[model samples]
Target chain A: MTSLPKHPPAKRLGLAIDLDTCVGCHACATNCKEWNTGGISAPLTDVNAYQAEQRGVWFNRVYTYEVGGEGPDARTVHFPKNCLHCEQPACVTVCPTGASYKRSEDGIVLVDHDKCIGCKLCSWACPYGNREYDEHVGVMKKCTLCVDKIYNQNLPEVDRVPACVAACPAKARHFGDFADPNSTVSKLTRDRGGYDLAPETGYLPTSKYLPPRPGKRSEAMPAAAPAPAIAGAGRFLKWVDRVLTR
Target chain B: MHPAYSVIFFTTASGAGYGLLVLAAIFAISGLMPATAWLGFVTNGLALGLIAGGLLSSTFHLGHPERAWRALTQWRSSWLSREGVLAVATFVPAGLFAIGWVFLGTTTGFFGWMGAAAAVLAVATVISTSMIYASLITIRQWNNGIVPVAYLVLGLMSGAVLLEAVTRLFGVHGSHVDVVAIVLIVVGWLVKLAYWHSADTGLVKTTLATATGLGRFGSVRLLEQPHTEENFLMQEMGFVVARKHARRLRAIAQATLFVVPLAATIASLFVAPMVAMVLALVAVVSLAVGLLTERWLFFAEAKHDCMVYYGR
Candidate 1:
């Protein structure tokens, strides 16, 4: 039965994020929240005063950071984190109510709102912090990869992917079945060298992030410029020095 | 780790309630009763009320209150499951013990032992609850193994302190309370300090190297975020701390939860009961505030595996 259920092509639909190409504008996050809010799947909630600038409702978020590296070549880094929908998801197994579970077919981690008691225990269990509490419905919220729109026949075929992936102007995000070696996402990962968020914690998230490769720099040395101090000395002293050198 | 006020209240209230239940049952077993049926009844009633209140308060943390029953499952691996089961176990025995000892004049040894066992279970459950966070390997501060031991010890200490205060209200033993309360509070201080000392270790992992799983890549850095508007990191592990503020807070917490409390206990032993009592109250308030602050710092101080992207 298990072998029969196995994906011959291994269609585990997930994203391969190219951090190198991402502009860090947060369009993905905004579009995701917007599409998800209006979509038939489910809505993310904004708690407290909606008027205040501190509104919260996003399946994905971008964080700006300055990662210190060895040597003088260190610089800032930006990370947009969400549920990786791991091969072995701790959030799913740790869930007492089975609210959080990974679909064997797509490997997408989702919470069944009806079954979820909003215990927030799953939130604690997840290391990635991808799950958020929708205070409005009192259920856990997470990235669904726009499951509602993806399967909807009413929508255009090009717009079938996640809202976040569709709206990325920088084209940093890719949605495909990485389980298939020939898939676009898988090829991109292999070509660019993809990585996981926190592999040490062992959540084994399915989503992969392609590390930004350091581009090649020219080795040709620039011509040395003359010292400005040479022109600043007293005329008599300069003349004396020149004569002595001669 | 963000020191959710709801969680703080839940752990504190529930732990104290569990401690009170355990203490009262122990008192009954040890024959330290107040020589009146009404007194034992009142003590049991108060303990029971606190416990019920604590359990009720715990539900506030849940997203779905109706699914609370499901928490009883996963006892095999989850400390939370163990805690829930133990909480219920404590409650049933306590209820039976109350009915037997308070209302029924029958010195039912069965009920007595039931209460005693319940007390033991309560302690076990509370410790298990603490371990749920403590055992996690990701969050450096919460990952410490001593968290459970500290929590249980603090529970007993707080219970003893509360007991002393209550007994005083009833015009019961005075000097002996000072002695016991002092001892418990001192133990709490030492355990807390020990916990703080032990939690300093953190699991440092190379971010780019870990991400690549190959030393071939010289270094790794996030050139872009996956999305915008403060995703999960800002929500879950977005801890902020200023060094100056942290140093000041740590000093204040050390004074409040440990030094001040310890000194007060000693003074309570030596000086007038009033001064000692005043200090003890200060210690309680200080410890509560300090521990809460410490909890916040604990979360803030602890670095997550993902934080390497942020250069933390």
Candidate 2:
């Protein structure tokens, strides 16, 4: 089962992240943890929760980088990263057990905890470092794309998107069926020039990231006229006149 | 990249085990080694013991050791799965050969064919093991042509030295074995040198800019990490070794693994049987230390592609 699906999936459900608007607030990350901890892959396992060396498994992480040089074009980019649900995910194929797999129907990669041996080879195979190891459960965990919530009939249709996408305050994360040409994610990718992370790895990630757009300088305002030269007494009188007029 | 001890031990020990099995089969089939029950028992016992022990040790690092049996189910796509399956299947022929040789005191006919089968399986298992590392394109240092070659040669070399020590201790001497050991020592070290040279000179294809798809904006640099504390990715893949220490360790590995073993093996060819036995034993010990050091370095020096995210 670790072998890839013989045929490509018809639907590629994925997210398109806008780096331009992400505030690096980590709200999506925390919301993802909050939802997923009690969702399909429960108990994210925070070790030493209150200690100085606190560490645990998390599916999404945000990183800040200074791109370009110290000039007008320079910008600070907040990059939020997670599993891209690659079409040809090496993490699935490298698994010795048939635990890691991609759904042929939707192209969503998932891990079956019961079948995992916890060898961690899948983690090594991932270039994006998206897979997280749960020390307590002794199994690999990752972004499920809120599969449980997305499919639940009890939840409102508006709440069916991924927890991260729904929780993004700035609407930086957009989730939809990328396989459809008219889908929001697909159009966003086309319009914003969204790109795959680590494309050189050849994973063909389904998710895309919209690059940060450069800031625009306003050119509509006119330059102010210089004040007329005046003698000391006249300048004082002018200042008094200006103050009184104000 | 964290250099887990269990994995290092498993690779080195099982590699040597398979190598010994191959050599033992060749010796028996070609009439190089005497067909004695005691010798057969000792040789096969040692080979199987090392193999089984190493394989068991490999599970020590697994998070769910109780679920280790599931690892054998995915051979169709996974090299690690293939390795596990091949390793276990090898035991069948190897066990039969051992029984035929030790109990029946024969190294010919059906038993000889069985030995041949075992040898082929052993070599295949080692190759599978090597492929587990080589197939990983994420690590530039491991995804190379020379990794499997170096692993095979070093395994064989270590086996040859161990065989020499055991045979000499039993008062059985073969000049051809000594020559083979010396040749393998030189050849194995040469392959290892090539591997190290490539690792040293190879440029990392993935960088922060490429990793984040931000190269078009010019050079990208990490202004702030994702978290203030180290996460699982950082702890598991962020391990870094200072260049100075790596160089020193490489020299030590060269001296102990190649220089000393090669010298001792050659000198054993000319000395008295007792002195030769001692020298062979010394060679075995030195090779063991050197192999461990080299294996440690193998993990320590490897930089995972994920490390680019951590600014490693």
Q: Which candidate tops DockQ?
A: 2
**Residue A79's lDDT in candidate 2:** 91
Interface RMSD of 2: 0.7
Q: Give the per-residue lDDT of model 2 (tens digit) for B118-157.
A: 9999989999999998999999999999999988998889
How many pairs in model 2 have backbone atoms within 3 A of each other, for residues 3 or more apart or on separate chains, i.e. clashes? 0
Against the reference, the lDDT scores of all candidates come to: 0.68, 0.90
Runs in model 2 lying further than 4 Å from the true structure: A215-246, B242-244
**What is the per-residue lDDT of model 2 for residues A149-183, given as tens digits with 9 covering 90 to 100?**
88899999999999999999999999999999999
Judging by lDDT against the true structure, name the best candidate: 2
Question: Chain B alone, TM-score of each model?
Answer: 0.84, 0.98
